[model samples]
Target: MSARVTMKDIAAELGVSINTVHKALTGKAGVSESVRAKVNDKAEEMGYHRNTSASSLRRKDINLVFCLPCASREGAYFYRYLWEGCNRFEQEVIDQGISIERVEFVVGGYADALEHIDERLQVGEKIDGLLAYVPGDDRATHLLEQIAEAGVAIELVDGDRPHFDRLGASLADYSTAGSLMAEQAANLVHASGADARVLLLAGDPYTDSHYLTARAFHNYLRDHNVPWQVEDLTGAHAQVKQLERELKARLSSSEAPELICSVFAVGSELVADTLVSANKAGEVMVIGNDLFPESALALRRGIFTNIVYKDPVGLAYRGAKTLGDYLLWGKTPADPVQKGAVEMVFASNVDRYCKLAGI
Candidate 1:
């Protein structure tokens, strides 16, 4: 019989140390994704099989930290769903030697939250993995680097920092969602047999998702030769009253847009309400993002033309699951950036979504 292959043999063949091979095989931190993939492929090629009895004896409890926004924070209604999804994942893996600790910060307070985590790591905390929503800022990036250096695997949620050495990310294809909305807008205008002015109300320009969605929306219109004059307003979703006033002003203007596309859920609601208040609900077509109770109601009443659902619950669930599986099973995700499904909901199918969401 052929001799059993070993880590030593695999390491020698791959031109790497046995420690690297061990880290890859055992699904521990410190190995890059590329090296892990190579090590795994070579181990399988050489007929290497782990000693299950020894591995079981050496296994230890995994500690995963979920660093996200507090559900009670301003503009955090979507975060509540993310929290629920993470809790669901934790429950499923409670008996499997894995534990999840949830850490929250107010919206726009990611820098402080991440600094606290960095302090913990500095004090030698044994954090195996982290599922978080990292903001794009210099301080946050530096802290993330330090945490990664301490050998904690990170799986980002909502958005991705491709420059960071994160295990993976779970987020919506925002560009696609935006393009879908743009396509729907084009169809609506085409059916009307006239050129229409369009307004795009986008959220914080610094947010990757919001930026991508707005960019895609504009690009689609330009690429498809859609003869619509588009005016994009950035940072228009920061406050309810502010958005209301802006929408009211736009609605009251003589050159009010024939179509309005809001990439934020609250912005969509405010636009619908303002249009109704101005008695222009029938004069404008509204396209929005997300499927919440208020947005669902607007769809039913024909105040909203269509909505692009980003599926926050699904994104959070997958992010947590990916990090958990990586820590517990030495399994790497199939894609470095995992994208959740985006759905387009209209009045015709809004009831089905409302029933699913229990709204």
Candidate 2:
């Protein structure tokens, strides 16, 4: 049999232990830079190319995969940021000369995501790393474990998973920032009236992180003893219109909600649109989520009083940079990349920071 040009072969050529090769390959905690350089030099001289296929037999790519359980742009209100971020990531990677693949896996239950993983493996599409904007759920956890076992480094971009740190990457804490927006909404209600009821519209379930804002809103209201009802309005435009009518009826009734907080773009825009058409725009205190085009319009028209905007372009730039760093240098992200918060947007800055994205 032809001798395989493996890490072991490189180690043997350098008269070093196999563990040394492992350290050299991973550039892990203890190895000196000089030693790493030497190993790399020797491996190169020995014509040792990393056999990704062979590596998959024992381990898999640690490069990266950006998985969006379900890439539902129209149906998912929060998908705007995810799509924008991933698109930015692709551009950034190409600019940086890194070999990383970003795939939007159809979002399904744990079983479905796992099935996708299996399909990728079957096709011999090796994944060394995965960046996901996943929901916080058991099924997500299981799929994460399976991906880890395959030796792919995983980062949850805008969500949290209990075992994400163990997966050798990191998670951006949207929940923390979401709480801030929620608190703002609470304050809006407080200013409006303590007896004022509220209606919170949530984004799609495509990623749990998107709903973090809603969860935070709920908590804030509960803490303040404010009465509120939450609804999820995700899907087609017709469905959104239907939800708007339902919300309108509730708002128009004698027991109408005084404050409407939208935690998703579609739903928020729907609420705003409904209010405008009903000529009840200024009657209700309105807050919208994610300053997409529609939300921006609503804000400009005075339909939405406040916006909890998330910077999709920033997320994309950072996610791509993180993936590139991991692939090129085997390094991890130093921060969430959004600075002081897991989420940042036009609403957070009085100077209109989102304009930097030119969107």
Candidate 3:
């Protein structure tokens, strides 16, 4: 099937900037009459369907609130990228009569943040749309319901609560990531032609992403008939010191796994550091998740075998844009869950990813 035509596609075909094409098509005053005619003619030739609903909405002001974890929180490495993406999107749409206000809370403080949002709504604050990384907790669910009932459109990012009637969601496909990591691990084990035990540093089981990743990893190995015993080191990502201690203990034990896998960015560096300290850096194969300064360095140093790169920045940007489009153009995402792209990073290509990630 042919894809829907977009302003970008039109601009590319006409050798013009997207902004110019947008102005011309939208009948904005900046575009010259000649250029507007050309654009309109090309749009018609290309079967562009103008959205009358969106045209009306573009004249209205939009106010959106972004609720997320603060960068100051420990183990917030991933959230930092999310913030960057959100800010980038904000800057891109700054001149479009759209206002994005950020509301940051400490990690694991969703209830507090939701309560604050509820209070603001009660005080007659005008919120056209809201984007948040809401977890599946009762208090969060209750507050989210209240906010939705208050006529505020909501879009979830990073995680999702399926029961909630949200506009849409932008989430990482952690199950696919986990399965990819498992395949990499199995390939490495097969290449060595030796039986090896695997340890999965699975972050909090309650979190949907973490739980799905861990389950997929285990299931993949089992389904493939891989002869590897998988063990889990389960805990919240924020408990850095505790996780480190537990990992260190396992590394020093008699039944220490030969392969270590981390499905999240939180403790990937810890895993590499512990392996280096225990003099098992190159001896044991390590599969990490996400690409940042630390993990990139670990990959370059041969301490990490591979990294399942979950593009958090892209996820956040897409999520914010999804909500923005819904508010400004009356457009809805085709799917309820929009999964961001994932990549596999190795030493040979880690530098390229690092540069792309602005690390």
Candidate 4:
């Protein structure tokens, strides 16, 4: 027998470092597919098999788990695109013997997600790393901490808050995007040549990303010498009737703000609908988040002055890759705080953005 081939023996035969051998066996990022194939062939030739027993395993294999938010009927499309991104990354590393499991929960169900996590652990499927779409809740944050209490890496996508003591996060630069959107809003207001005030629409106060963007928009409006007012549409995002009622009430006010800025996807859709239905679409300059179907159409028709599009797929792909790098190769992402590229679309460029984004 070849003297019980060890990692050193494999490295010597392949003329590569022991680290490369380890990474290949674990299906980790960093090593190329060709090198991994060479290392695996040699390891198999030496009759070396991976040890996957839960206890005292010499060979470590990574198990990357996912927990994504699944919304109800109305917001399901939003989650559909987010899942598309996650699935794209999932397909890339699926053949490497690393198990990837995705646990889903309802739109705003933190308790459901935690229960599902407990149920998953009961099946003895160990988690080396987790990539999840974080929501705006303190309990869910605590649940994530508990899941990773055993030293598992946690990578957050779409939304991130390192201050909550998370290991890493991949998302778009909301604060900066907000500032850019503000500049666009200012331009639209000035070009309109009216006493247009910004009617800032924001989601729940706890939604850090949306809140940050609203703050930036408000600050920029103040700095640019424009007037603005805020309407808290936090819980009403998924509520159609409530959203319409609130938007209608605000629009019918004595001094209605002609410039509407929606800071979230659902909010944007609702705002777009209200403006179109009221036939005031052209009059009110709308600046908002997301490029969902409604918002895309609204932007295409010049109803939405500017639509800020965040790369959903990029966030998921990068978050999954980050976890793979950390769990498989013991490599931390060079930038732990990764942000997706933000694209700005106007009526003049909506077609190009739509074609590129496949919306």
Which ten residues in a row are the worst by lDDT in model 2? 163-172
Colliding pairs, model 4: 204-234
Ranking by lDDT: 3, 1, 4, 2
What CA RMSD would you report for each candidate?
5.9, 7.5, 11.8, 8.8
TM-scores for all candidates?
Answer: 0.83, 0.68, 0.82, 0.77
Residues 35-74 of candidate 2: C-alpha lDDT, one tens digit per residue = 8999999888777777655443332224456666344654
10 residues in a row with least lDDT, candidate 3: 69-78
- Judge candidate 4 at residue 69 and give its lDDT: 73
Residue 56 of model 3: what lDDT?
Answer: 60
Per-residue lDDT, model 3, residue 3, is 79
Indicate whether candidate 3 or candidate 4 has the larger lDDT: 3
The worst-scoring run of ten residues by lDDT in candidate 4 lies at 51-60
lDDT of 1 at 96: 88
* Full-model lDDT, candidate 3: 0.83
CA lDDT of 347 in candidate 4?
82
| Tens-digit lDDT string for candidate 3 (27-115) | 65446799999999999999888767667676458899999878664435578888888988999998999988998887668888988
Query: How many clashes (backbone N, Cα, C below 3 Å) per candidate?
Result: 0, 9, 0, 1
Model 3, which residues run further than 4 Å from truth?
A: 1-55, 73-76
Query: lDDT for every model?
Result: 0.81, 0.60, 0.83, 0.73
Give the poorly placed runs of model 2, Cα more than 4 Å off. 1-64, 69-77, 95-97, 100-102, 105-114, 135-140, 164-178, 186-195, 202-207, 221-242, 334-354
Error of 1 at 176 (Å): 1.0
- What is the overall TM-score of model 1 with all chains considered together? 0.83
**Candidate 1: regions farther than 4 A off:** 1-60, 73-76, 236-241, 355-359
